[model samples]
Target: MNLYKPTDERIWTGREAGQNLYVYQKVEQIDLELQNIPVSGDKTFVLMGYECDEGVRRNKGRTGSKEGPQTARRQLAKLPHHLNENTAIFDAGNVVCVGDDMEKAQSVLAEKVTQILNYKGLPLLLGGGHDIAYGHYNGIKKFVDNDQKIGIVNLDAHFDLRSNEDGNNSGTPFYQIATENSNGSLDFPYLCLGIRNDANDKILFERAREWNVKYIESELFHKQNTSYVINKINEFCKEVDFVYLTIDLDGFSSAFAPGVSAASPMGFSVDIALVALDTIISTNKLISADVAELNPTYDRDDQTAKLVASLLHFIIHKVSLL
Candidate 1:
């Protein structure tokens, strides 16, 4: 099977032509097949798309999120470039999932992510489903030493620890990771923010406790609990040498992000989400991140795509400073 496909360079064109002014104009295109990928003197970010929704399909959810990367790329292209000249951003194409082979697709994604990390590049992955977490996490895990502590910070409504006895679907990635850790791997310190109590059941909560997953409920994401949330995040960051951040679009209110596999009517807003993101990024331990479950099929006027792009913009701008 072909593990990946190169991104179409034409998507990086901007409406207004300015020297290094917008993302489209400033972004560089690179083929991952190449032996040598040129890195910048400063921080380098690589965008890799995982084009598959088989996991969501198996999980009995809506499925057109396979096109998320393409839609997000189009939105990201027109955004203004806020990074310094030395900060390089490269589009590393995508890891395409063929047929219903979620395992193969995820393995390929892990290899690609490991490649970027080996090149000293921070991966900003575009997901086909939240199952991207399994592959994304393993990629970082493969790159870092076994002894080095790594933590997972997930922004989502679900614990994603469902049993994969039937099969590994979108809801079983974290459980899979936890299972792997139980087999004598490194410590799995997971912090989940913006968890909606209604989305997860008692069994899931039990699983979370069994795995010792640290999570903050969606109700605690308001101004009154801002300091408390930040303090929790800080404490989590302090326990790990590295962090892998994953954002599920369903974690946000349907008004802000309607195009997702699972819609959370009582989800948190983007403002408070940004606050949590800022706290995590400030730790300077984030190695890579991904945004998942963006199904454009249910989007209203491209609202969710714009939100994802805007978040990407903010992340790039902030990471550029580091």
Candidate 2:
């Protein structure tokens, strides 16, 4: 597979695009024999892909920067098609882009994610935005029975639990999930973590109170050490059979991760964030994971992307050890 350079501006197409974006060399085909690895025993596979580019412009504006299509495609190209030799990784490529139809974009994402889950492999979804979580959760809910509750640990600077007042934008993922589940569709235990105080809407806060969802504000990080955060997460994870982990880059301080839709002044330090993630992965119940809301435009010389990539590496490595 062709790996695009970090600064490349070319818009790849056809087989080149597929090879550049989708196929990874880490693991063999989904049906092929798994390679032996010392860490996780080669049982885990990763379905890696990018989705939801329609809101890139809006998101860029929100973050006070501009990483357009070319930058996004370039950054994605730099990601490993496969992270490890024994782990099969699917690079599902860019399923949506700007100027594309919204319904079409959503449908494509739903279809691709559904295919990824059908293999029964853990999906390591790279994001175009947090809204992609709605599609991700939508796909997961299809395979799980109604009685089997899945827990979600959303690490974000903002509570994305706002109602879809203007439709399914990037800001309304958790809200969409909650709305869907309320009607007897997708029933899951959801937790929002690392939220800053200033980022939430009054309505979202009211809804969170009404739903009794457990959330840890960003202020809590300053008030306690990493162990405190880890223990809180562990308590939540213990109540559910499976867990979905979503990390919004904005959850980190703008100094650490400035390339997001809304960079928060008050967020976790990188070390503390890593400690919290370590605690989560150690639980051995993370079924699917995604890192979202990474807009390279506002990033300081690609620092945010590199940080996100490192986080992904840590997640895979730590999970492999488990």
Best by lDDT: 1
Q: Per-residue lDDT for 1-322 in model 1, tens only?
A: 7879989987787678647788898788888897546868998999999998999999999999999999999999988886778899899999998999989999999999999999999999998999999999899999999889889999999989899999999999999998887757423699999888799999998878877789999999765788999999999999999999999999999989999999867998988888888888999999999999999999999899999999988888887786
Candidate 1: which stretches are off by over 4 Å?
183-187
Which pairs clash in the backbone of model 2?
A: 22-91, 24-81, 27-88
In order, what lDDT does every prediction score? 0.90, 0.64
Q: How many backbone clashes does candidate 1 have?
A: 0
Show pairs that collide, candidate 1: none
- For all predictions, the C-alpha RMSD in Å is 1.4, 6.8
Show the lowest summed lDDT stretch of 10 residues, model 1: 179-188
TM-score leader? 1
State the displacement of the C-alpha of residue 103, model 2, in Å, after optimal TM-score superposition. 3.8
Cα displacement (Å) at residue 308, model 1: 0.7
What would the TM-scores of all predictions be?
Answer: 0.97, 0.78
